[model samples]
Target: MNNNNRVFLVDDDTDFRESMQWLLTSAGYDVVSASSATEFMEIYQGEQGCLLLDVRMPGINGLALQQLLQEKNVQLPIILISGHGDIPMAVNAIKAGD
Candidate 1:
């Protein structure tokens, strides 16, 4: 499979992550999953693709991980997913991209 076709899925919810992985795989996307931002960081090796990130993980939240990725200049695009999200959080996520 092409490296660019991979999807890095980072979420604390085991069920959600696995479900997404299964769905994406069924859709023919190469999916890589981790339970937390910390685990994602530990396993990620500069792969080129999108990041499907959960917004409320334990160790590092999605926003924090996005910031860390920015600091490290890792250019993977992020799609934030939150079961409970507010307007401020949405605003912050948008602003962070700037």
Candidate 2:
């Protein structure tokens, strides 16, 4: 039942990542998580999936990650959620993902 799209999440917030992982798994979706862009890249494996990510992390924020992924042309569907002030930045994220 899980792994339908193999949801991949990368966020610096450990609590949020764990909570989302639990929720997604309970909903019968295979969810993989990473705390940083580096960690996510380590296991990325060029797989196709849906990605849920935060915008500003310690290193390689979501925008930059979108660039990296675009370079590889991995074709991953990404959803970016940022804080209050990051909304404008998140708009850029949408363009980058495109």
Candidate 3:
């Protein structure tokens, strides 16, 4: 793992997000988290890192967020996580080149 590696975690679950932040930090990764896509966009500035997104977030879902990032020419790698019923959506997002 790169020492300067960072992760942008976007999820609606506060507990999950906090837990992930702690786990990533303990693993030597710089982690930044947001409760919604809107919040993430407010803070993201084309930083060099990967995006860990929850597919079912409120106020702009993960796929939509990926599209917005693409529109803005932000090419960071994205990892989408979803519940069982949301797997199709996640697959579609990946198939769409997110």
Task: State the local distance difference test value for candidate 3.
Answer: 0.86
List CA RMSD, all candidates. Answer: 0.9, 1.8, 2.2
lDDT of 3 by residue, 1-98 (tens): 56258899999999989998999899988998999999999999878889999988788998899898889889888988876546567568878563
lDDT of 1 by residue, 1-98 (tens): 69878999998888888899999999989999999888999999998999999999898899999999999999999999999999999999989977
Residue 39 error, candidate 1, Å: 0.7
Query: Candidate 2, residues 1-98: lDDT per residue as tens digits?
Result: 43355999999988988998999889877888999989999998876679988888987988888888889887889988776546568678767866
Candidate 2 residue pairs in backbone clash? 3-30
Task: List ranges where model 3 is wrong by over 4 Å.
Answer: 1-4, 85-87
For candidate 1, the per-residue lDDT at 45 reads 95
TM-score of each: 0.95, 0.88, 0.88
Candidate 2: which stretches are off by over 4 Å?
1-3, 85-87
Sorted on lDDT, best first, the list reads: 1, 3, 2
lDDT of 1 at 73: 97
lDDT (0 to 1) per candidate: 0.93, 0.84, 0.86
